[model samples]
Target chain A: MTTQPHEHIVKSYDEEQRRLVEEIVRMGQTAVAQLEAALDVVDRRDDSAARRIVANDDSIDAAERRISQDVMRLALRGPMARDLREILAGLRIPSDIERIGDYASNVAKRSIALNASPPMPHVAGLRALGLLAAGQVRQALRAYSEDDDELALRVRENDAQLDRQYTALFRELLTYMMEDPRSITPCTHLLFMAKNLERIGDHATNIAENVWFLLHGDRPLPPRDKRDDTSTAGPA
Target chain B: MTTQPHEHIVKSYDEEQRRLVEEIVRMGQTAVAQLEAALDVVDRRDDSAARRIVANDDSIDAAERRISQDVMRLALRGPMARDLREILAGLRIPSDIERIGDYASNVAKRSIALNASPPMPHVAGLRALGLLAAGQVRQALRAYSEDDDELALRVRENDAQLDRQYTALFRELLTYMMEDPRSITPCTHLLFMAKNLERIGDHATNIAENVWFLLHGDRPLPPRDKRDDTSTAGPA
Candidate 1:
């Protein structure tokens, strides 16, 4: 919650809003860790890491549920003006975090799917690219925790680079599939995981936009700016 | 707007909640149209239809903005009890609808990608599967507008069939690519479109769950039931 000087007028109100921020940060930190573990599963083919991400998802879901209940509870007290925006921002950010968790879980599932396949060269590249995307998620979480719009805007701008990374890796994956038909199965799984990471970056951007709104009330939603992931991605 | 017969405690409050429902119905109707246009693009390789969906997304975004604005305004009025859930549902449903539109647009974009590929035989199968998913979207929207929990629950149950349809298509598309490597690029686009439709169904379920809460008070978010799309999808 952005604190206006007048806001601490109600001490419990300030405390409740602080609780909301605390929940978002806790939820976000867990989600970011989940994304890293999910990628490490792909990079190392570590079944245990993948299972941990999959198992941990339920707790993330629970975290979002707690935040949602808290938001609705506080809204019962009738927050006005900026306080209302803070509650609405609460509604928006958790779903994005929950989805980021889902994407990470999906990646872990892909690890299970690819478990039988022989390792390929591009797994390292996918993780390299994935780390770039993960860093953005971390930054977005920071922006929210600190109410730092400049950091949020930087995350928003750098998202195009993530899209480009996905596009480039997509081409490499396709070439790998084409050159050796046997690579098709595991490669396709990798493709979906790569797309999932790119989307994770987009979800991070979604959170950054909310942070922007939390700081400044109503700005028409920023027109999406970026070469979407398909820019260098094949025919599509 | 689930009516408690004894309570029109504040007439303006009841009307405001009704207006909120009306806005969601309007948003749902436009989204349903966008889904149809998006599917038509896949069926006909219709560029103009795809363009129409891409262009009309602005209106859908506007619709969400209006609802969010209205919800914030009503929250300021201090809705509690049943009215609180209605406002929370308003927060929940529109974001899901906005995402459904984004997926529809992605499908439309995929239509353009496949327009040039020597038409694959599986295109029709994709369209058929897409319609099954679309019908659920329609049903979910109707459930919200009518406050029909049974219809919503039926939508929830039928989602399994959509997942099965997508998994089946994934296997088929993979087989097509393997049989003719030349088919890989186009088939991959179609694969993504199929996945998009599958995700659209997931979004519909997300909305259906919100409908469930709107009608009944607080319920633990249902653990996701049914076959996820990956149930039979091939190796990662």
Candidate 2:
């Protein structure tokens, strides 16, 4: 059977939609790379690299603004189910990306302050967490671009692992402080950095959750203790 | 000169607008009081009070939401310049109020974890920070209500004092860790709690900045340097 004119228009629209999704995935990857670079700067005390990351923040900010504007424009133009989901997902992805950049910049600023000092104890654990979180960010973006629901779910699973790592790191840092009080200064700052990474993981998982919602439209994940439904406590 | 009938309507609308602004000030005071209660729960290890504070979150949220909706409705109906600024200020105060609740809940969560343990070192400082921040929140709300730009400016100035207090508290905790490694556990948690209070102060300052913005419609405040900017290169 000959293809109808409406079919041709729909095919073109799908292609354009895919293109937009791809752009967002690329932006996510860029943000992940920025995180990695910032971590490297922190690990190595590379002021030059840290400065570069700081300068690059404006670019990430601009990218996020542009993506948000584009999403708003496309949404106003009317969208089909998949197209609508992609557009909404696009809007949220950039916010996560922007926050990731923010966390990276924080690490970079911390590095600048450390001024080439030796890495604190548990630095390796912090790096590992950073790498894992960066990887999750990239994988989540890929899953969204390909509409791979399973990969998105895996990204969500990884957040728990990151949290566990953070908890362990926190305890280890505490032990170090218990052994030697002098370590407290660097250790406390390190704790904040670790918390920041854990927060980034949380945000990545949030993005993954949004991806899941776009695909399945389920109720957003309930607070962890939904079964403790003593709502008589009311609305907290 | 003969009076226009429309002038009478306009005069009554102005009176109602002023009354709405006053209501927002009252609401803000209630929110600040709620935050103070939440802090007391933490300081006193009062679980029931903590639960009550958590329950009160919904009321704060609801009040803020209602005020926001009201502002939008009023703006849409064509508010004059002064009324418009007052309404916009009203809209912003709730966000600051909500954030205060968030900080209080954070303190409560930490209190729950402390589980009736004797107050940690610098617990007094944390309480001081909370009180100071709660005071600023109250002052900012009152400033918005009365359009007292000078009072708002004074509230903004207090953020620096909060920062100074936070810095001192952090150093004291470091000394504790140095004195005894076991102190690390409670001190680290307390550090996080202190940071949360400091952040609440920062948020209050942010609200004050917005108040300034509303009053003058000028460029926003200069970005404050991040507090975690201290270097590990230095000796504890």
Candidate 3:
């Protein structure tokens, strides 16, 4: 067999590395989709949607496995400095995405639990807060796939506001639980769902930070929001 | 210069690899210590321990930075097959440990919030659960440091038990919140603390799984437990 000059055979290393990045991007999209479905379940009490979200997590975990393999292969072949960080990015980004997927699944589980309870006050607030969280995840992934630090920084900045809103929502839910004990059960699931959303936002910020590190090398990241006393009511 | 028969006195890419592993092991110790301190804060409402845990997180971050650098340096220098996996382990394990540290800080923050509120019924349960979570982290790290698949498997298996205990604790807290609305506030804080502990357990399992992958090559990890329904009383 005569071997012709091959134009497509190149990029053995680059292709696998690219696949690792692409796989993570796909995983991020799936995670965002999962979050949307999970939030929808919360809003609609749709058991099927919850089931779908929980089932989708396996694919995200699978994507992480694929990325891990690609990273290992490329690492064994040895990478340049930049390639090394990219490989590290391959490792770091997926775990955050996977964890985000887990948070979405947790939200889905809460949704199933919420199915039995009648809707409580401030349930509407969750829908609004969820939009914010979902937006953060979307933007964070965009920054990751496109390597846009501006969008990543925006994601990081919005997380503080997200945390503040979460604190506000937690306070209001507590008030509802205090006012109507009947609200306690649904409200309890809602609070955990809200906390899960806030955590999803944190994971999004974490992805943003990873993107920053991937692009910027060893530069120090800005401090994430530390203000926890945002509730108007003093702790009692 | 006292030059011996050595070809060159330089990092043969192996020493740095070992240091990378060593650095992660040291970071693991610090993270477990932080968890211990954070749990102490929750148990005794020790303000100083809480502050110490919060402050200690920066060092863990620093530890992660060092590991990241080591990983990058080794990858750039190029590594053998085994060394490459070890380097990849350096990249993955530190992120999980760092997140555990962050969870510990969250527990510490909740501890401070609970400082003002009177102690609720399940506070002791948190201490017990914290021990379990802390022990898991320690054992997972031990598996990581020693490359012990059996111990890592044990860590993974025990996470289900941890989740079940968490479910039981959540039901009890919900009952307390329903019975006395005053327990609502402190119970709310306790619930978040408990959630943080559950998450820490999840991360420990993650580390154990990473250790498994690092030692045993690519393989399918079993499905983690998905049970969420454990509350005795139905919602609302």
Candidate 4:
């Protein structure tokens, strides 16, 4: 029952891969929590708390740096084709997560300025969008940890819904700005905040796509619908 | 004297690496060109040309995919520590370039909507910000191709100037919107376009940092200033 040296190497490599997945999952969760916390500060108009969330983004950035070092170390072990895919995903996914953290931090930062103005009803819409984006990110992280292509595909399919929500809110904000001249400054802040949430959804979708690549290699992903039409939107 | 087989493999590997750098440089140039074209359409208010620029973004995306495949292939060749850095840069720099293309497309898309409105003087300001961003991106690409860390640092340091320009334009747009409520819709579009240009500047800094990583391994980058203050800006 003695283990060969090759078997020992394989086991150690397996453990390293598992550690990489675990670290990414933790990093993803940190980003998700940051997003939720940012939404909370927006709801309560808690400027100090929002600033804290902005400061907290550095931890997610540090996590990315550490994971990158780990990926580089693992990559130098001369992995095979499949492990090479893992290495690529290892690099790609963390960068996406770091961006998610940034968007969340941006949301918090905007919430601080948003508090300076009188409260608007659009904050509720932004919170809902932020929650949907957080949920998608959570699902994508799970898919990556469990290696679930089905869940990854689900996350990818769900981005269009987020996009649609974003577009609806975008039109609503524009209408609001048009009606009330006094609301222009605050409404502009809400608009940027909502856009940040939409971008968070896009980043979640990016993580999901990386998960698919990790599982399926070079197989093409089916074309999915993109419903984020705000760029072409105008004042109606 | 006859060359050894080992030397032949080394020569071919060097050639492959050179090809990778060339492809990335070309891809980066495509993105820069897209940014400039998007600005042109903004200046001329040409909806058809803007749409064409939007369509051309697909090419930059395809370039990124091709570069990623090449990086994976190089990674599989079991490169040494230095080459591993190259492979990592090969993956990262193009993803940034691809995003630059996307932001350029967004600018073009927004320009279509903007064309429907009366032209304003702010397009000139956006053009200025975009050209600065494009210049930074061009320098970053050159730094990558030449492996010049000093030039990369210069690109990194120059982002604060871009940010200041963006914030100034942001405040100006906000002031314009407040003064003439009739201008809010078009001004809003300009705001987003300016934000896209600002994000382009940030991506250029990312590329410059990646170049630094490629050259210096794990050494920490010197802290740089960030001047994008629009998130906290208020209407004056």
Q: Chain B alone: TM-score in each candidate?
A: 0.90, 0.84, 0.89, 0.96
Q: What does candidate 1 score in Cα RMSD to the true structure?
A: 4.2
Off by over 4 Å in 3: A1-19, A221-224, A227-236, B1-14, B82-84, B221-224, B227-236
A best-first ranking of the candidates according to their lDDT comes to 4, 1, 3, 2
- Clashing pairs for model 1 are none
Model 1 C-alpha lDDT per residue in residues B1-236, reported as the tens digit of each score:
68864465467777887888888878877887888888887788787778778878878877887798788777766546556778778878998899888888888887877886666788888888888888988999899989999898888888988988888888888877777777778877887888888998988897898899888866655565655646214732
**lDDT (tens digit, per residue) of candidate 3 on A57-166:** 88888887777766766766643565767777778788889888988888887788777877665767887888898899989988988999989999999998888888
Clashing pairs in 2: A178-B181, A181-B178
lDDT (0 to 1) per candidate: 0.81, 0.69, 0.79, 0.90
Q: Which stretches of candidate 1 lie over 4 Å from their true place?
A: A1-9, A220-224, A227-236, B1-9, B220-226, B229-236
Compared with the true structure, what per-residue lDDT tens digits does model 4 show for residues B1-236?
Answer: 68687778878888998998999999999999999999999998899999999999999988998888777777677446667678778888999999999999999999999987889999989999999999999999999999999999999999999999999899899888878888988998999999999999999999999999999987999887755688876855
Q: Predictions ranked by TM-score, top down?
A: 4, 1, 3, 2
Winning model by lDDT: 4
Give a tens-digit lDDT track for model 2, residues B1-236.
Answer: 69876787677667766766776777667767876886787678787777777777678766765665554445434324445445445555665676677666666666665544456757788788788878878788777776777887887887888777777777787777777775666676677777778877776776787688778865555555544334333334
Task: For model 2, give the TM-score of chain B.
Answer: 0.84
Question: Model 1 — interface RMS deviation?
Answer: 2.8
Q: Higher lDDT: candidate 2 or 3?
A: 3
Q: In candidate 3 chain B, what residue range of length 10 has the lowest lDDT sum?
A: B227-236
lDDT: worst 10-residue window of model 2 chain A:
A227-236
Higher-DockQ candidate among 1 and 2?
A: 1
